[model samples]
Target: MRTLVIGDIHGAYLPLMQALDRARISPLDTLIFLGDYVDGWSQSPEVIEYLINLRSSYNCIFLRGNHDDLCLNWLNTQQHNSLWLKNGGQSTIEAYKRITQPTLQHHQSFLETLPSYHLDSENRLFVHAGFTNLNGVNFEYFPEMLYWDRTLWEMAMALNPRMSPKDPAYPKRLLIYNEIFIGHTPTTRMGITIPMNAANVWNIDTGAAYKGPVTVMNVETKEFWQSDDAYTFYPNENGRN
Candidate 1:
């Protein structure tokens, strides 16, 4: 079975589905989602529902994202986060308004249970955002850090490419895993939308939350598929910032 790593969805249900269709994801393939399943265009609830149902067909590993934490805390803890609302929580709230309580609660439970990172048997690390330490640290301690650290990615990018693996300055995190996959930082921010490679890290977030395609990549081969621009799917709506 192949392993596919999907980047942030940000409620673009159509793009998400299109990416999956383009990738031809099957029941036997393992899907490792890098999170941000909600809060963007108009289909946050629909996106969550699709993922929930996917459990029956695929081996799915859903990592917790910062936006996901915002939504979950609002739902389960009844938080009134102004920052989250300003960022995209309002879109999520509106989407949930159309969903039933039972459905929202079920998805909430699943969200709360999601791990911050997943380490596969191949020693490949899957995380929504990178971590501070790669020494098998449990996310239960710094739950937020696991899903919100940019320094981890920056650290990888800052690695002296000239340094040998045995050098002391080499990132300790990369040594712990065969390869690391992350999505919190969108490659579009760098003025490009394709999956970008830096050192041994791969950034697959192609800005679907804003105006790029949702991406799905083959973990082993580094082959990838992308959807049409997510904004075109909802021509009348402006996705959240």
Candidate 2:
């Protein structure tokens, strides 16, 4: 079966559907979404609904992103920080409003149950943000590594003899996994960056919700696919648009 790893959607429903259509994804294939599924765009509700429906029809893996975590937190407490509200949480709130009580509860449960990181038998790891390694240490605790700390992961990727470190936040891991698929940072192009790395960590976040492409990569063959449309974020007069 072909395994397709998709980057952050961030509620860009049209582009996501376009990417899916272009890729010709099928039920037999496995689609692993790297999270940040909601927020950013105006169609947060539609995007969530589409993903929820897609799960029933195909083999799909959904991981929790930082934004997803914020949404869950707000749902439980009815309040959140400015970071959460500033980072497209308003759109998610609007999405939640359209749902009935039972459906809202179900969606909350789904978000809460999402794994922070997923590792396959082939040693490929999928995480939303990045990880931290302590002295050749491999963290089996997925949640902390997946969503919270990124210092060690950044250091490992940066200092490693492989790729030239672009961001100081990138970490280096001594025990390299076969492949690591990550999203969170937005890139202008859909193609793989840090290609010189021996560790095979691929950043597929093409910034679909912003001025960039929505990327998808075939894990086994290293084949890539992207959406045609480009998006950009513009701040309004009040610093929100």
Best candidate (score: TM-score)? 1
lDDT (C-alpha) at residue 131 in model 2: 74
Residue by residue across 1-241, what tens digits does model 1's lDDT show?
Answer: 7999999999999999999999999999999999999988889999989999998888999889999999998998787899888777888988888899899999999888888888889888888988775574463357678789887778877888888889887777778777889999988788888998877889989999888899999999999999999999999878864
lDDT (Cα atoms) of all candidates against the true structure: 0.88, 0.70
Estimated TM-score per prediction?
0.95, 0.81
TM-score of 1: 0.95
Q: Per-residue lDDT tens digits of candidate 2, residues 1-241? A: 7999898878777778888888789999999998887777766667777888999999999988887888788888898678878878886787678789887787787788888877889988888777765322245445555665555335445565654445454444534566777887655443443211234567777776565556777888878777764353223211123
**lDDT for position 17 in model 2:** 81
